[model samples]
Target chain A: MEVNDELVDKIAALAKLEFKGEEKEAIKGDMQRILNFIDKLGEVDTEGVEPLVYMTDETLKLRADEVDQEISQDEALRNAPDKDSDYFKVPKVLKK
Target chain B: MYTSFEQVKREIENGKTVEDITRNYLETIKEKESLNAFLEVFDQDAIEQAKKVDEKLKNNTAGKLAGMVIGLKDNICYKGHAVSASSKILENFESLYSATVVERLLEEDAVIIGRLNCDEFAMGSSNEHSAYGAVKNPHDQNRVPGGSSGGSAAAVAAGLCLATLGSDTGGSIRQPASFCGVVGLKPTYGRVSRWGLIAYGSSLDQIGPLTNTVEDSALILEVIAGSDQKDSTASTKKTDAYSTASKFEGKVKIAVIKETFETDGLDPEIKKNLEERIESLKEQGHTVDYVSLDILDKLVPTYYVLSNAEASSNLSRYDGMRYGYRSERAEDLESTYVKSRTEGFGTEVKRRIMLGTFVLSAGYYDAYYSKAQKVRRIIREKTDEMLRDYDFILSPTTPKTAFEFGANDNDPVSMYLEDIFTVHSNLAGTPAISIPAGFHSNGMPYGLQIMAGSFEEKKLLGFARTLTE
Candidate 1:
């Protein structure tokens, strides 16, 4: 688990983090420690066990998908940190 | 401040109006400024609700929790309130719908006192990673309130609220509750609905109560437990009579795992106290057996891989394009996603998200995520086998008592180790609770964990109630 600066950069890109100079090494150290701990999972004998993902033993009971409540456009936009008329405004997301 | 929820409820019934209760609680929260428990206090809404509850009391329509104040961990949703998981990206985002627990609590006529602080997205062991700030232990301000449900624990511990609701993924509720000297219960997975809870690890995430006593915890559990049509993942099983279950007097068959006490790096006092507690249970006619869970060593890694993978997918919905915070300047959609996420999430969150993506990505899924899941299944099966013979599995909630802020700041591995005693229950989807067993040498609270088979919360809580008494 020798996490290098290059791997740190890649991890940062994937994670969408804005890491500075020394922070990369710090994070690298953290990652190494975590990966080392995670490595211990290899020791367990997991033969023939079904991967338990969702805990509910029963299937998700579904109802006819119906609207319980409706929020007005104005109410929806109230909490937006950045907003415009009837729309949530954001940094220009489309590029040519 | 009275620690029992019954005491608080009695005072409210005697003449203290709901308004008086909320005001006194707000004042108490202000006085205990050292405990950084709350992220946002819903002052207006709480007052309004308190007044309504007061009216209900006068009209002789008070419910079980009439005029009782409750603190909500920031992760639980409350309509018209900023329910950020103590991350900046969601700092301004108000929940559009109340979480199932919130609705149920309101129906019980409980007052929503405020939102307690938490680790970002309920991720960290200590509340230090919260953007708002870390919550200090009410017992000792220097130490952390164990997290990611630190605030809820602190609020209850400090008597700012009668009880609080928190979401537990690995051990968020129980660990913090232990650290803060409260009763924290994690119901069987799907015992409580997760409809409005912002998903952490959807499969493992469960909403439970943090209260001063196991009885209060059960009271809150009764209101919020059972199947919900809103959350498909919620169990369809009938909610049991928790209050009645709490009164069961029996010498419980308790199994204290040998490996759990034998774990390296435990505080000596915690071990002594746990042993003494086990002896006490035995003296009360309960059989205390030493069980060995050899798979205990694999808990930490399996938890991280499974939790991070599920988290990566669960959090993908938070992209600024759909809701919450957006960066001021984004050149394109990719950068918009990048900058918003970069600005919105904290360091720990980014680290987990990246690690999750890495593990689940092409060429790595089977080796990492899938392998972790397989190991998780083994842990579950082994645990089920153990529970067949024992009514409960007991352990120290944490290896050591509450540590000072920054005690493990430099070592992430050390921080992850705090979850060692608590992660197994989540992996097995069992009901677990942490009650105050004793105190550490440092004068901080120590927690004793009791876990039972899935859907055995009544039995587990019954045992916990006896021990706590």
Candidate 2:
């Protein structure tokens, strides 16, 4: 598939990233080249084959619904770039 | 230049205090500062930990890894210590809890010397993508040490630390080990816990060891591998006594993958070394034959598709709200995310995240992501079938030895292709290792890769020890 500038913009938006003017052009070329390379996967006949999501045959192990360990609220919010006393502080989601 | 864990352990037993050993490594780390291997050296904490180990040794109650100085790749979390994954997005981020592997190492009295540098979020083939800057090859300062665990490999190669913990997704650990002329092992996918490791590709990533010798690699694996309640994907299989790997004696059937040697861009010197190694294995009574892996051409593409798809989803949490780098220019939530991510991630990371977004985006998911998954299963089944007949698969760890800086800086495809031989084991979910085979004419070291079926790390490591010996 041809990865054009419009598609690049869409992907960048979905990825929550914005490229500068020249970066967008370079990213477009890179995306196109990489996509073309990965396009060869379509040639392999995967008829009746299941998609392998997990490498191991073992299913995800279940644990009893109990808190084995707990961290204080201060510890939980320690790495937040901007955090109030009990919660993370983000920029306004709703504009006036 | 100490190569074995036993040598260090013997010194400790012979009255060389753990504090002295730790101080020696700290001195080497300072002296070799130009290698740019470590992001942070835990000098004070390491010395204190060594004192405790020395106390234990005095009481004759030392642990398996007592007094061993080790380094952790920046991605592995050490509680209350910085773990950035060598990216600005995680700059100044301190881990709240240690990784299970880190906890295990501490339990065995391993003195963690420091956190080493790596590719940004473990994305690039060369160490150039690190926010801190590139790590130079120890053999020749102008060349790369092969990444994304470049610093971990280079540290062990240069004796900055005896061994280091590095996570492998695709070829992160093994490729760097090959370039740096050290031993690196990527165990079966679920063999090691991924709990406190910063996730890049959830499915493909496994934490392993880079060491100066295969026995040291085996010892580290034995300590770190097991089921973890915190990591559901960690295997529930019983952990083997990997330290006893030398006891196993058998003539194994080994297949040299024909397509790997025939691939374009493979250095002729590496090919010759692999050929000679095969002859030597045959002379030692092991059956060595050439096998054609038709799916070899598709491995790089399949690996990129799946790994990037997972990376996009995994990295979505790095938005400016909770943790990591935040942009001051943002006035709103959406702008915060976009601006923070744009300014925080490096070019290679952005390229991958964009590629991942494109593959997983609407109207193209089936064409790229789903098809790649199906092809992954095909590759896995083919490898499994081959392993059913052969005991192990052998190939060159990388296409070439360490290359000069800016060699493939402009060409991402060439860098991605460098992982072609190593990614297969990750996709197949099998255990594989890279051992220094010989030096190139340029004097840089190359490695021979050995892979075995899933959960066969003991056999693989045992045979690797034989080859290295």
Candidate 3:
């Protein structure tokens, strides 16, 4: 559970966040401490126990595929930080 | 200051208009502005709502919660209102629709006075992590009002509102209730619908009430708990008559978790108060015994791993392009994601997201995420077996009373340990409540936590009502 700067950077990348130099050091320490704490779960024997993904025992309710209500494109893009009249604007993913 | 639901109802019945009551709460909120309990107060909207309620009262067609003023945790959505999870990323994001709980409150004629402050994304135990700022405890300004439902508890304690709706993912509501000397309840996970609650840990999170009394908490729970088509996970099970929870008369079988009392961090005063409460319960003819939970030490760690894992996934939707704060400095799509997230999220949130991503990542998925999930099943099974025999499980809500600001800010692990007694119910998806049991020597209040089997909120509240009485 040794969370080095490289691992912290890798995790941060996956999480879509960046850390400055000093913040990275501090977070590395924090991650290591937390991981060390969580490492105790390894001691427990979970041999045949199925992982409890959901708490309730009820089966997922399926519904017919139909458009019940619709939000206009204007309403949909209301909160978008970068948007045109009918579309959300984003930086180009594919470079020339 | 107004104390109970009955008192407020009596005032309205005695010719006090709903407008008068709403105004009083607004005045109190303004007077206690230094406490930072509220993020925004809906003065005009609340007055309009109250006027309608007054009209209903005159026509003798008022709903059950007519004239009661309530506050909402910032995370719960009210259509067209800014519903930030006390995070910078969502600081300007407005809710597109009302939460099921909010809609239910409006139906019951409950006037939502304001949105209260909480931890950023409900990630931290203390309110200090909030982007708006930490909420000071009404009891002691220097100490924190325990969070992430700190403002909900403080507003109730300070008489700014009769009650507040707070979501409890892991002790968010109850811990603050304990610190503020009010009642906070976290209903069974599926008891309340999560349709418009900004998701944190979807499975662990539940919407509940923070109020001055146990009866008030029960009344709110009764109004909000039920099935919703929007939330498929919301139980199809019939909602209980929770309002009558205080009417039950029986000798309750209570089991005090032996391991909780033995914990090293438990304050001596809290321990004494809990022991006395147990004695009083026994004196009242309720059977009480000690039960061992050998996995007590593992609860906090297990909770953090599982909750953070869910949180990372749930929060991924907050990327810059969709909504919320976007970086103006981004030159590419990847930088837009990274820079927006880096600037938007606070330190604690970033720490948790990274931790979550790490555990759920390849090479460590089974070692951390899967292992924690397996342990979670064991915890749930053990709790279920105990509940089958025992009517309720009793313990201290927190190991200690509220601490001074920044006391555990640098030590996140220690702060996470504060949830030791409360997170078990969230993991098990059972109903649990925190009631003001006693005051600590430091002049702050601590609470007794009572937990029951899943969807047994009526029984749990009945026993809590009896204990509080």
Candidate 4:
């Protein structure tokens, strides 16, 4: 039930987001109120209830593996902010 | 401007070429650009499509939705066009492929005018969270157009488009329709394909139409609802003749949740309006009754817990490697991921992502995420039990009509509560629709919501048409 900078940092890290000092404090406060609000779900008696993952009782319909359409490499890399000839260019991950 | 698809068809039959109609709507969009309802207008593409539809009509081979111009809620994809979901993360990202809804509607000869602005990543109840700007309520410029489908609904209300497609995760479609005084239908979870929609809560989201009339909503549903191999989760059910909605006959039993009207969150004017509609239904020989949902008070909490959890998972795909905005401050892959996400996403999106991550964390997973899932089961089961005897469930779409901008900016929970009545359908996986109920004392319009059993959109639209007429 405790909300603090540590919790916010942990969550932000897990979600692949970053929060600076003042924003972190503000997010902690906002998240505290939100978490407290959602905490009201703790009142329900869910003893034997199964978690409903998918809304339907319909069994998962797996499609047979096959390629119906294929786009060219040019199209695939078209939206990348930075890209090499055929690959998306990201900042260097390792030293040569 | 036409009021419904029926009118559009009639206009075509009377020699009003689809091309002319497209131009008129484009002019309206340009005229009402101040509303910020549309993020972009596909002017040339729409005209070209309209001309093709005219040729098809001349050959008497036109498909359904001929001459009907509609807008997309930014989140739905249209190949070769930009789809931002009104977030900087995906800004200027052109869809490599069209959503199933887009393909189906285009096949049926519908003209897509443009993509409308919405909440960033379809995350907020008000369109203010949009990266572009807030969409003004067509009815009142000073107030918000309810969101995350705010622009979709506003486009329909302002006659900028005949109808629009909106992705409803919680109340995105219905709440905005209520605020804009239009008919919004969120089909059963799998009734429509989610293949092209940028994911929010994968389990909760469904694409539906916001239109000026129930008939138009039904007509659009007819074209877009069907099974798809691309989206295996899309139901294999055969499409229905939803345009026959008005032909629906016989009296139906409807239940109005007692707890909804009792809640302090409800405006007294809205309470009075919905009660009067219930009375009208009774006078029409339908059995209208009040049923208690003891868990009604907890709807928002249950919805937020489950939806945000799914959002956190669904949004992990936005790593800056492949496409979308890449932060210039990145030094390495890790910083690229963190910095791009932190800089690209809005505050609301970050807040939800953080909450989602927390709830699904190791120790808290069982307590928050799993427990909310269990609570969701209760909500769905309870709704199913109610629908067994009643053909439909009814309530005011929102507690109140549209509010002035910045009213709930300081309080996030207050904004989330606007989904109080509308989230029931998303949780229950039941098809639901919001039709114009009447105006409030403040002169802003609201909608009356009607929900039916899963895969029962035919019945839901039928009942909605009867009420709308």
Candidate 3, residue B356: how far the Cα is off, in Å: 0.4
Instruction: Give the per-residue lDDT digits (tens) of candidate 3, residues A3-93.
Output: 7778987888899998888998899889988998999998898999999997788887966778866567777799998899989999888
- Residue-level lDDT of model 3, residues B246-343, one tens digit each, is 65597889988899878979999899888988898889898999999899888888999989999999999888998999988877889988999899
Instruction: Tell me the lDDT of model 4 at B148.
Output: 96
Give the higher-DockQ candidate: 2 or 4. Answer: 4
**Candidate 1 TM-score restricted to chain A:** 0.83
For candidate 4, give the lDDT of residue B94.
Answer: 94
Candidate 3: residue A88 Cα off by (Å): 1.7
lDDT of 2 by residue, B26-77 (tens): 9999999999999999999999999999899889888999978999999999
Q: For candidate 4, what is the DockQ-based docking class? A: high
Could you tell me which 10 consecutive residues in candidate 1 chain B have the lowest summed lDDT?
B244-253
User: What DockQ do you compute for every candidate structure?
Assistant: 0.64, 0.85, 0.81, 0.87
State the TM-score for model 4: 0.98
At residue B58, give the lDDT of candidate 2.
86
Error of 3 at B43 (Å): 0.8
| Candidate whose lDDT is highest | 2
lDDT tens digits, residue span B1-469, model 1: 7677688778876887889888988889889877878877888889999899889889898888886689999988988788888999887788888998999999999999889999999999999999998998989988999999999998999988888999899999999998988899999988999988888888789999999888888888989998887888888988888866765476566788788866879888888888888787777788999877787778888899989988888888777775788887666777777788878888888878877876887766877798898988888888888899888898889888888999988887788889998888888999999998878778899788989999988888887787766
Is 1 or 2 the stronger prediction by lDDT? 2
Worst 10 residues of 4 chain B by lDDT: B239-248
Residue-level lDDT tens digits of model 4 in A1-96: 989888887888899999998899889888989988998988999999999887777787888999765678999999999998978889999857
